[model samples]
Target: MIILCEGKHDYEFIKELISKINVKCDVKDQGPRDKDFIIGHVVDGKRLSYVPIIIEGGKDRLDGNVRLLISKLRSVHGSSTWVLILRDSDSNDADSAFDKLRRDIVSLINNPSKFLLYKPSMDCGQGIRVGSFVYYDCDLKYMDGVVHFRFIFVVPSLEVFLRNYEYVNDDSRLHYAIDKALSDPGIVMQ
Candidate 1:
């Protein structure tokens, strides 16, 4: 599984969350560029390589970047890998944010074989908002397989997660780091 975050700070925070929850996975930062594109191709029927396609226009073109990454990934590989896109709901309306994200993802995928939305249950300040789908690429003869993609929105920004956790020290630092990064011109929420 590849976990894609908005920036370096978001990636670090997610790394902490994954460690606390004990989930073994590879986490990647999407960088500060307006669009960050990563592609992977199946080799020897074994694994995939991370190849990036960078475009200009900064944060405004985020959706385009994500779509490119998904399109390229699905076109080559199968459902063996799942992509988890972790985004922040900076404005407090997670539903709308997720809806827009879903639309963007669906637009890139012709017709996903499976699509599901899981609402967040903010019980005690911890929750999860998830959108899952399975899309197939018809280009590769032997690679006519599906790729699973998911979008997870962190409510009110990722600060909520850091504040609710027990093991993290200097919670204020974590909060400031994420907030500052998201406030930058290179960061886009919708």
Candidate 2:
């Protein structure tokens, strides 16, 4: 299932989950910009993509859009599609929002469990206050049967993850190679 979110931070965070947990899943960082316009398409025999964004000021962020997306899934895919909205559960209307979403989308889905909205953030921080785990937070932790261990390696924040982890850090060479680049003036000048 392609885990879609609002922005890049979420994308990086999800990537961290995939890497840290080794879930072997594809997560498409479909920004809010591309979500509303997306309707439905059966990419392969297994994948079904739909655009379901229902926040504030969003074009397709309503009951109608939920129903529409589900309808498209049912008609085009001819099977149940998992449209999991991993949205932020914050502010006053958080749980209420999910309730409204479930109430609207339930009728359209073959299985209600297939459609869901969950907050994957740590400690359940809400509204705009999202305490998302950085790649550093994930580090690398393996299991040992029933118990667990930690080898806390500081992996930096979301921006650092994008830059260092994914090699999207053309902006800060100093961060990319602070010590070595600093040691060589030419590298800094370059």
Cα lDDT tens digits, model 2, 95-174, are 45544544444344434454343211111112232232211111111111110111111122334423433345553543
lDDT of each: 0.45, 0.33
Supply the TM-score for candidate 2.
0.38
* Minimal lDDT window, size 10, model 2: 144-153
User: Which has the greatest lDDT?
Assistant: 1
Candidate whose TM-score is highest: 1
Off by over 4 Å in 1: 21-38, 41-45, 48-62, 110-143, 160-172, 175-190
Q: Tens digits of per-residue lDDT for model 1 on 15-94?
A: 65554445554444444342222343332234423312122223335455556555555344333554556666666676
Model 2 Cα RMSD, Å? 13.7
| C-alpha RMSD for every candidate | 11.1, 13.7
